[model samples]
Target: MTSELSWLRRRADKRAEIGPWELREGLRSRSSELRALLEERKLEHPQGTPEGNRVHRFADEALSELENAERALTHAHQRYKVGSHVAVGQIHIDTAHNLLLRLSRPSEIVSMMPGILAIVQSRLSSDDPRRARVEAIAQSPESIGEPERETILDAVGVARQASIRENLRVRSFVNIVGWVAGCLAVAAVLVALMGAVFEDMVPLCFTPYRGLEVGGYVVVCPVAMNPDPKGGRDINESEASATTPADYLVIEIVGLVAAGIAAATTLRRIRGAVTPYNVPVVLALLKLPTGALTAVLGLLLMRGSFIPGLSALDSSAQIIAWATILGYSQQLFTRFVDTQAQSVLNAVSAPNAMPPPPSPPQGATSSAS
Candidate 1:
């Protein structure tokens, strides 16, 4: 065992004197040396004595190191051959291929051997059996001219730039889609608020007299009416027929579009304060029927009646006017509105306790305590 260890140490020391080519030529002899040492260790350590076991371990380590050194030498020799003959681009390709093999399996050659593949493609002009060996070495034997290398690099650069441009275009398209979605959301909210402000403002049920005299036919104006016996009539035929219901509907739609723009503008201003970046603002005009329905529900919780002087206008006009103001002042109103909603919820949950007093007027100043 001691003799085996001394022999292994001498071989390891001799490894430092050999070049990669010389090492490659000596691989067979070295493998034989390892095999011989392993056999001697096994015969002497049949029962696995401590000294014999130590000799076996040392031989195994030496064998493993020798195998690794052989592979290193082979790769170094291959690279030397490639660098001396192949063009700079081809050399790069060969290096990349060698790295690929190290990282993956031999089966991965189809995808990992692009440089060798390119060389083969160029060699289609000549029918040489030796070209087959280039695949094993994973490099080209013939050096590519400067013009060919430049052409290959240019083509690769162009393809890379095209891919980058395509990515940018996709990103821009996504951003546009997101901005349009945001606009639609804003428009929907504005239309909803408008409907809520005017839900009860217009007369829903009405009556019109069709009775005619013998001499002259006559038509009575539409009069506002309700199904409830307790309800009172509020509007005359003149106001109801002055503009058709369809016209009012149209006005409401137009107002919603304008409100969407106003909302978008307000949002842009708020965003601008936080960041210096700017983009062209476009508003979505389409309004969903559900928005109008939701507005009807919102009307029940509104703070006050229509603003002063707005009463002269039609119901749709009045709604649009109020919606515009609310859109701009949403941030100011939302906080108090949420607090009031919570208060209402609390009052309902505890029916026995008295509801809290309404918040004090914003205009009223309290004396400092």
Candidate 2:
């Protein structure tokens, strides 16, 4: 019954929408046991077992399991991919500690950060045997008591609160997205319904019957809007009003906003590995389809016509133009998001798998400070 972050829960919901990662293959049972041990600390000595002997054996097994779990995570590239729409995978913090496999809390990234940090630190000091040095260091025990532990835990609680606040920001953006979509939908319905009711040939000097014919082409009181509202700069209002044919409008708005947010988020994630940006970027990207659709709606409205007439507006040319517009819009947004995401990812990657920069020559103060 391990409690997990709510964002992790939300992320899990997006996996199928993205795609599955094959990183979770094999070693499920081992992962389960490790999770239990980490949670319960249940590897105490049995009645006859020697305390030191039993603890040492347990530590060895734990280390081995940790190695295996870490290897699985790395090979799967899941830490990075978990956030990707393409990495459809499930994580159970209680039973699997899977969400930690995503790059949420750095301290909790046991297989990746803490272990690697410790190992790299150990390998650096080329003094005695590396194994001997690490073993001696590991043997050193801390002198913390209950009060200190409590204080540390309390600090952790505060940090977790910050994470909760970040999560709320994400939820807020979700609300914004839904609201934008809802507004477009409602406006379209309202305006269309109003127009349907008011079309008694009153606003027009002539109806479809009065439309004039010039040579092979016909142009008249076609009721097709006054000089085409959406076709020109002056008609932007008509194209952008809440009342536009909103399917495309909503999707397009969503796509532009989402793609933009995703691009920014991807960059932030890779560069600073700004953990807080994850939710916002994701929420924004989730809104992309809406943006794309909204833009499409604007195009449709630009090629304006009455409801009965719009059916005729559905020519192969119109359809192709619209499809091309929407498709290209989606692609443009995707490119930006991908580029930024990769940039951020590149930065977050092991900045240096090599040893730490050499300390200022013996007691010398370094300029790095």
Candidate 3:
């Protein structure tokens, strides 16, 4: 206990150099309270009953978990850096967050009685003495004996497990999102590199019927120079010089810019929560490379005359405008992802309420009647 208190004091002294101010302050406050609780427990005489021993053991284990949580937070703060380190730090912080949440739950369990009672009411028949006892205890918590307390603790344990599972699911989803974003980013870079290296081989140029007349044929490329309009050569021959790596690069940049705007619009959907995971940031990143890829593909589709009535683009400004539109159009695909992410966030942010009871079978209700 003394060592733990000393560690807390030391961390408090270095508060400015640690994690976020809010987290640091919250941990400091909680640690002080936990230390006092442990001290009080230490002062209690050893009990002979199995339940008393079990409760004491649980308290000891809780203290150990709290210490581990503190260490995780400290490690996360110390290892904080950019790139992959950011992910590692976030994982550590999340671990600490979960542990702290579980450790602090017992105190909040009293307030959770309504939900617990709901669970008990649903599972146990109305006339069951144990169910009645639970309800009575709920009405007057001071009347709880060891057996009643044990039953309440059992319910709380089940709820805690569910909460833990939900947190794990959220973490798994965030990790998957981060991986996908990374892959898309890599793919975008590769595409850009391919565009740069094989510029003429895979040109983004198009031959519009109404383009600048070259040898009586319309030739259009994204470059400033169009093959001499009066050279009297085929339109295909002029396309090579007009299209360069810069065309694809510029379109990609425009697409990225448009995607960024779209990403910003999603910020309004984010809810404030105490979680260490940054789902919004990951979701935003997922949009960026997707936008860039879509922009390039959209323009390519147009260049190939795939979209009737909008096949031919006459000017550089027109192509850029189209790129911007395509970039923003990434939302059409990412909207589903946004919806899913929102649902996940909502699940995590939901109050620690009990799940609704299952409805009775239609046949069973009719039979009872």
- On residues 233-304, what C-alpha lDDT tens digit does candidate 3 reach at each position? 656567776778787788888899999999999878777555546678888999999899999999889877
Return the lDDT, model 1, position 199: 34
Per residue, candidate 1 scores C-alpha lDDT tens digits across 27-143 of 445445545645565566654677566655655555555555444444423442321211222223333323222322234333434754454433221233333333333454233
lDDT of 2: 0.38
* Alpha-carbon lDDT, every model: 0.37, 0.38, 0.66
Question: Residue 365 lDDT in model 3?
Answer: 73
Most accurate candidate by TM-score: 3
- Residue-level lDDT of model 2, residues 71-132, one tens digit each, is 44434334443332111111222113322232122233322434533433332333324333
Model 2 alpha-carbon drift over 4 Å, by segment: 1-35, 38-40, 43-148, 200-369
Query: Which scores better on TM-score, 1 or 3?
Result: 3
Q: Which order, best to worst by lDDT?
A: 3, 2, 1
CA displacement after TM-score superposition, residue 332 of candidate 1 (Å): 38
RMSD to the true structure for each prediction, in A, is 30.3, 14.3, 7.6
Error of 2 at 270 (Å): 12
